[model samples]
Target: MTKESDDNGNTPITGDEKTSVPADLLNIEKGDVVDISSDDALLMALGYKPELKREFSYLTVFGQSFGAMGIAPALAESLIFSLGSAGSVGLVWSYFLGCVALIPVALSLGELGSSMPTAGGLYYWVARLTPTRARALMCWLAGYMNVLGYISIFASTIYGATLILVAAIMIGSDGTWQTTKYINYGLYSATTILCFGMTCVPSGTLSKLNNTYIWFQLAMALAVIIALPAATPKEYINSASFVFKEFQNTGFWPNNGWAFMLSLLTPVWVVSGFESSATIAEEASNAARAVPFAMVSSLLIALVVGMGVVISIAFTMGSDVIAIVTSPLGQPMAQICLNSLGEKGAIAMLVFLWFTSICNCSMLLVAASRETFALARDGGLPFSSFFRVLTTNKTPARAVLFCALVTLAEGLLMLVNTIAINSIFNLAIMGLYFAYTMPLVSRLIFNEFKPGVWYLGPKLSYIFAVYSVVWMTFIFTLLLFPSYPNPDETQMNYAVAVLGFVLVFCLVYYYFPKYGGKTFFHGPVRTIDEVIATNLQLEEQLVRKMTEDRAASAT
Candidate 1:
């Protein structure tokens, strides 16, 4: 149909043309088809090439995801609430459980990521490991759920930042910063716009930016630990040691127990985003090595640094804990700051906390965009072709824009009511954890004995998978219950919201036929051989060029 010339002025077969180049000369199989397009030609057509740069090392990867401002500030609040109920001893136990639980889970994910370094991460793994008929459905559901989780994370960061900022401004100027409905809505819109703008940058530049944010988070965390303790009232430390005399009843929830249990969800919300690194496996240089490192390292760092901040604040504020927890600012840390450091020190702490929130929002935007792009590339979403388009810089610019718009809409929706914000936030947590655990559960249930270089040994791996599933399920169930209200008026409406979102997913799956939704799970899972074959093709081309260079030098 068409013809072209190679560099040596020889006729090049083009447009599905089959040339009889000698099998030995090309060393290609009989049925193998090699398309010869110059780099410039491909670049012109595709707009970008797959980046093979290995600029990021393991440590950088870990820092970018773990050091994100989003996870720490949220978790800090959760830790405070949990410690208030269980005391320091109970709080210590939870951290221990988290560490133990995460080890095996991290190991299993590490093996999977290393063996199959695709950008789609767990969903791709699921697609390969599960039954053919269910791959598309599972992937689509997982994508939707994960998106919700990330959106929640984004919103929470913005909300937290706004709270701290408003609190500091009010305290500094002798103005009362009450947490009212309208103020919260205004904060949500402003933070969302700021976060969206940060994400519009080219993806290549994002990693370096994230790295800087990580350092800032670390510095702020250190500052809080040092400054809060030094400025606190000495009597506050004595009061912290006094156990609760009685479980007080707040009209919102039945008793302090339920209140505390629901409150534990706050901490879980913060410590997440470890999986954010996994979503970028395709862009990562040597992803297998980097993804695992980042995931595990971030978790460990979050654990240590988060604990340090929580314990430091707890000991410093002591008796003021109750007041801080019930404060209108909705920031437990700010209360601690006010109690220990007085007004001036409190303002400083709030500034740092807000700064961390901004950093967290920026990182979340990047991770969410990557997940969106990865799903689209696998034909798991509507209008997959548009999402697959990349900019000249090789970033999924379309997907980034799409995620930004969705975030903006979600933020705007907050103006409707506090219930709307709470509903979305709760649903986000459930959806994210659901997406996170499902692929692991699917692997455990179906392909427990699948062979691979990354195998974690049959018995231990399955046990870890089972444990992860159980833990995640428990957390998801608890999340459904209202954290701040009694059973009668509990946010049962939020559960309805979750169901509505699910229905939307189903409708998209069943009705959208133009995007190959019908064929999502129609075929068998792609084998490791197929993956290797694609990789080898690229390798062979490199080898061929090297050989040609040698021959030219000799001549």
Candidate 2:
């Protein structure tokens, strides 16, 4: 038996000493023992001291997830893909099918978040669930992929916002002005910096901002759904049959079914970031309950509201879907609005889209920075100590700054051409899904998963996990195919190359000779002693109270 004082100057029993439980604690029934009563305690139990402020309520956490998903705005950005593939019918049905497919994925992630809520999110879950021998490798892949996905999402959000802003300008200018690549890059850089600034605000203000953004998102979607149809010229409004049954294939796919499957990319990307709430689990009040509920509920809301928004657009969108796809305005949504709502209304809606896009960028940076900090704290990165430091206000300021820099750098790729920049959006979906797969695969293969407070039943949990893995694999494969077959250098999908590079980097970084991360990385470093000490203090308080109550009764 051995005992040692921990960093907090509390003596924690180690090895065989753990068997001799405290006398006071021994009298307490197992069920009566309070393991966690607050977010701080729960965090400590999960091997991390509470560092971030727990200011986000259930609503704010939901806002965080929903804002990151940016459903309506994201759909506007990716509408071209669906319109080109299966036409109006594809846009409506593909979103429904994709959202349905991803619900199981969200449920599986919610269960893991409840069981071991942490900022590391996917990577941390992988580490805790995988076999000892494979823990470091699995965690490394998940961590890098998760980080890359968030960075790519942030980059794409800013880029998408820049496009919306430019589209608005062109509409406002009556199509007299044209945007150059440099102009787009300049706008992307500015938006990235703005989002970074937003992310660096104090935690309390950030929570309020997130709450505000949620209502803002809802209002924007409702406005477009209600107004776009009302404003459409009578001649432009499509019949119900056209809106629901129209099918066309403008892309050069060998089969129309294959093209329809590829259109699932839009909803796959839009319904994502539900797991984002899990990334800030430690920073949310009642994290065990709030995290999972926020994830599932936010996704549900995004799906229903997002579908309404898309359906409204389809009803009002002009008959020439191909013309909308090949619009000179550079955005399919912009073209749709222009045809239905005239110049001023189009500009107004595009401005709303631009604002929502910026909010999405800011919201996503919060999750991205937290994930970066979590990985760095575990010695998973090169400058772990530096990246892990928190601001005086407890924000992961350094991580925010790092992500912002990466977002800015990624914008440089646009210099090559818009097609090259498209890879960022593709990588955003593929990389996140790749990270999501690791923990689910680990749970199924090891059979070591313990149900958390928010889990489905044992059988349902396995079912969801299996379904999520298979669906993600299917979507991932579809994303690798280009929009057009026999594509030249400019039209090719380079997401496969980019994702391959990241995977190879992860492999080499962990397995390379003497300096490999495997030598230093053990699963999540346990700070169990902190929680042990806290539990001991709570037990002592309970014992003291019980003794006093007994004496008073005797008197």
* Best-fitting candidate, scored by TM-score: 2
Q: Candidate 2: which stretches are off by over 4 Å?
A: 1-36, 528-555
The whole-model C-alpha lDDT of candidate 1 against the native structure comes to 0.61
Candidate 2 has its poorest 10 consecutive residues by lDDT at: 12-21
| Backbone N/Cα/C clashes per model | 2, 0
In terms of lDDT, which candidate is strongest? Answer: 2
Could you give candidate 1's per-residue lDDT for residues 1-555 as a string of tens digits?
122236784242223432232232233468665432222122212222233223454555675577553544655444444544444433444554555566666666766665555556666666656676576677666766776677666765666667677778777876654556567667767777787777666555676777787878888788877877776667776434343232333225556555555545545666667767776665565465677777767777777887676666556656544565666656666666777788887787778777777878777776777777767665655686797677765667677777766766666545655455556555666877787787787787687434333456778878877877787787778777654444344335364465466758655665578643564533223322332244544434433433343344346
TM-score list, all predictions:
0.78, 0.90
Error of 2 at 184 (Å): 0.6
- The residue-by-residue lDDT of candidate 2 on 7-122, one tens digit each, is 87434322222122333332333445333334554565567755677778899989989999898788888887788788898899999998877788888899999888889999
Measured on C-alpha atoms, candidate 2 has an lDDT of 0.83
Each candidate's root-mean-square deviation in Å? 8.8, 7.3
